[model samples]
Target: MWNLPYVFPMKRVMLMDIKVLIVEDDPMVAEINKKFTEAVKGFLVVGQARNGMEAMAQIPVKQPDLVILDIYMPQCDGMEVLQEIRKQDRPVDIIMITAADDTVTVSKALRQGVVAYITKPFKFERYKAVLEGYRHFKQTIMQKENLGQEEIDGLLPVRMTREERDMPKNIQAQTLQRISQYLLEQAQSFSAEEVAAGVGMSRVTSRRYLEYMAEQGLAERELYYIAVGRPIHRFRLVRQPEK
Candidate 1:
């Protein structure tokens, strides 16, 4: 009889669980993102970062398969982080979860190589779709050396699904919308505390929303120099939403 090795085909080994590192400035948001990622199959949140600096430091340690990064952050920005990641020539993938919907930011991110881009106040369905698509693409690409045109084209759209994803229950979509609308209506730059006061909400809660808005590109946060206290972050609406 002929040798079995020549007759039987070798089975292709599939990728195991995907390790993900979440890089976001807000702890609450990071936690929420962890929960969202856990809901998806074939993914595990391996680490979390509150800022770009920490993310940069943790990448080597955690060695995550992918990163869910935020654009606006203290110490180092997301773009800079993305550039540095590319410099190492690692296969690590990046999916940006930010409020920066501007052309410049989006273009830069694409040029730097991002798997997907999700704006702030996004639904969970969108998040799931992006992750699911990324998972499929990654698994396929790694298993096959050469892909057909159709296979390549299918993976191009990191987010092809139109359905909405669920957001954390604590982060009320309604309140976030109201706060965002109020910011658009603001005549001048205001701190989170000020927005909270105007909207009759707690300062902490307002700050989280403002931070997310700033990350998304709907608002800009300016740092004011202060003599006694730390720098104050005053957020102003950068763009108006469509009617």
Candidate 2:
């Protein structure tokens, strides 16, 4: 059976740990951020700092690959720490997690090169998404010494079209695209079970997507019965008429 990596050619590369440091003025917030960072795979919480002063003092010692920072703090603000890090040419990525939602602060952070900015009172799911995104971003860049255009595109964020964004919540664009590509390669109609096997997804999921595609006029659905058992539903890519 062909797996996802096999279907789309990919190189095997060893993944290194993404060391992280949590820098928040509030002790409780810092701890929570630390826990969230550790929840994601391939990330290690190297240290935690309660304020910007302590953060700067420990940054060189910890040498973390990333920092989860807060904007408001005593001693020096997060912005100052960020600027100082950049001024010193420290090789570390920052993700801002704070209540400062003003345009100037946000613009400054972007200028300082923060990979992600999440405002306060954000949901845990959003927090996880940001962390996962950063993980993928780091993994993709580090895997290759030199990246091709495709590799570069993979690193950048994809802007989903209106139709794609409106797709059912359960259906992901990437998976749909994969199934569509696979179906286009087939010469005849195939059952959901066959598609499931080909795409490395559950039969139920494959069936759902196939049904959706059929409804969207992307595929043609048909029913066929063998000698005596129950009839089975099969699907194939919709034939496009020649011009």
Specify the highest-TM-score model's number: 2
Per-residue lDDT of candidate 1, residues 1-243 (tens digit): 112111222244657899999999988988889999999988999999988899989999999999999999999989999999999887799999999999999999998889888999888889998887787667667867987543454456542231232334666667877887888676777778788988899999999988866543446667665555566777877543222
Residues 31-80, model 2: lDDT tens digits: 88888788887899999998899999999999999999998999998999
Question: Mind sharing the TM-score for model 1?
Answer: 0.59
lDDT of 2: 0.79
Clashes of 2: 0
Q: What local distance difference test score does each model get?
A: 0.79, 0.79
RMSD list, candidates in order: 23.0, 11.7
